[model samples]
Target: MSGEQLNEVRKVIWLTGASSGIGRSLALGLAAEGHQVIASARSDVELAVLETLSSNITALPCDITDASGLSFLRARLSHLSSHLDQIILCAGNCEYLDFPEPDWDMVTRVMEVNYFGAVNCVKTALPLLRQSAAERPHIVAVASMVTDAPFPRAEAYGASKAAMRYFFDCLRLDLRSEHIDVSVVNPGFVDTPLTQKNNFPMPFLLSAEDASRRIIENLESRPKNYSFPKRLLCLLAVSKILPALWQKIVLNGADGKARQDVLNEKVGE
Candidate 1:
């Protein structure tokens, strides 16, 4: 189906983290659907390139984590349009804390970028979203599926996302009376510049384009919480119900026992 078929009305959308990864692909997809996309990211050069891809896209580069620097963003948006119909909060960072004298600051750093950065975006964009001509404006945030289960070395990343999850959930309740809809999307592994650096295996990973397509399609319904890749969700669910089993599996892999077991099988062969 065409984008027009998927999206009924064109919108003025503010999308963060549009320089790369899932955000970049999502911006392109939304722009192609005839929405006025204001793409924001820290990289000026890449945002420039993204703008060149479509006439509907306007590159407005800014760091979401910089509270003081967000003045520039607010000014730019005011100059661009009277109100924003939608805002997609996709900017985030991850830091895994390894055992044995890990840098404890990684938790604060991850929270600043992932959780507080989202807070900053929402605080700045709330008034504009309320001023939208659309009857019920939308706020969509890209969280993570990792929040459903614990993982080794994911202390910082998981906690930050968990906080984000709760924050959005409560925000959804608070905004409902005002007729503003909020959605928290928890996506599984996707093949992106960020995930490419991950050392462990990523099962049932999706390409950025595919992930973007799904997000656009699903957000139309505006479910309160959306998580993808059912297989991964099931694994995380098991981690909740049978935590000991999950721990056994995770510990085996983390301690290299799984690898040694494979080697033993190879030797027998």
Candidate 2:
């Protein structure tokens, strides 16, 4: 659809993780464009602030990791709108493993939010999306480019996003028959509350607002998979080609000593 067409037609959208980061920015952007955005997040304070931003936005606070809360959210959504034209699943959690004494449970914790949380949202939104009058109702999952290349300490996060990407890919195939468009958005480093905690270098990092704008612009096309920025995607492609070189760069110090040392310092702080 063209920019004019998007502005002409209003869509009922359900956006998760709207308290901060990309989700919050997306909700604001969509609402500004005259879309009815039902925004959700775990933070009541932040959601309340968002609700004050525009009448197009409705704050619905719910923890993606909480099954009961999500169930309640579904009921609330049903009451608010019988159908949804779009559902953006941006809710996710990230955790790095501390090697040698890694917190094993963190893997489950991360997956529960990043992968299963999205799954639950899809379950709740699919039926609503089926009722859409639009030619193609959309499901957008904000995954990560970390899945394209292996990163130390990002095992859980990378794995969860990879799983999400695959699941959505399969879902796209199945939902094609129903005219439900599914797009997996794989973003590189974006300066959000999540990435603000990173101690390492993040090349090509875009601000959350810029990232959200890019995503919103591209989403109009409803592509199967949208990954950005092109520069970072290219870098990851090169890394995959040279396995030995890639390993050397990732494990710079022998036995990953340099990586571990940095992590240890962060933990100390």
Candidate 3:
């Protein structure tokens, strides 16, 4: 659909992970645009604050990983509004694997929140989206651009997002027959609570508000896949083309030492 057409419709959108970061900013942005937003997150306190900020937003606090809770959420959604026109599934988690006996359980933990959680949300939202009075209902999943290029210690985070991305891609095809549009959003480094913990550098880092604005604006076009920060995209593309060199450059430490060299330094100390 054209931007003009997108502007014409005020949608009922359920935005998950509305407690903080991109989800929080995006919820406000969407609400500001006059959309009836059912804001969701695991934190009741945060959701309450979000609701107080704008009448356009309603707080629905629930853990996305809880299947029983999602059913209850569907009931709450029905009570709040007749149908859902769109759903922006932004709920995710990240955990880096520490090498030299990495925490294998972290893989399950990350996948549970990022991948399986998304799958559960889609199942819960599909019925509501089908009831949409709008001509076409949309599903947008907020994935990470880490899938474009591998990063050290990001085994769990990147793998989970990559799985989510592929799931959405397949869903896009299957849902086409039903006319439910699916969009996978892959964002580069953004200033969020999750990223603040990283000890390494994050190039092209954008504020959550800026990222939200870009996401909300681009969703107007309903592109199947949206990835941004063009410089990072180009870099990842280069990585894809020349993997060995990419690894050499990226795995090199902040002080121009290779990862092995850094490890050796630590051992010597």
lDDT of 3 by residue, 107-192 (tens): 99999989999998998888989988888899999999999998888999999999999999999999999999999999999999
lDDT (tens digit, per residue) of candidate 2 on 53-160? 987888878877777766677788877777889999998888899898999999999999999999999988888899888999999999999999898899999999
**Worst 10-residue lDDT window, candidate 2:** 1-10
What TM-score does model 3 achieve against the real structure?
A: 0.90
- Candidate 2: pairs in clash: none
TM per model?
0.91, 0.90, 0.90
lDDT of prediction 2: 0.86
Give me the runs in candidate 1 sitting further than 4 Å from their true place: 1-9, 254-269
What digit string (tens of lDDT, one per residue) describes model 1 on residues 17-41?
Answer: 9999999999999999999888998
Error of 1 at 219 (Å): 0.2
What local distance difference test score does each model get? 0.86, 0.86, 0.87
Q: Write the number of the candidate with greater TM-score, choosing between 2 and 3.
A: 3
Better of 1 and 2 by TM-score: 1
Model 3's alpha-carbon lDDT is: 0.87
lDDT of 3 at 198: 79
Worst 10 residues of 1 by lDDT: 1-10
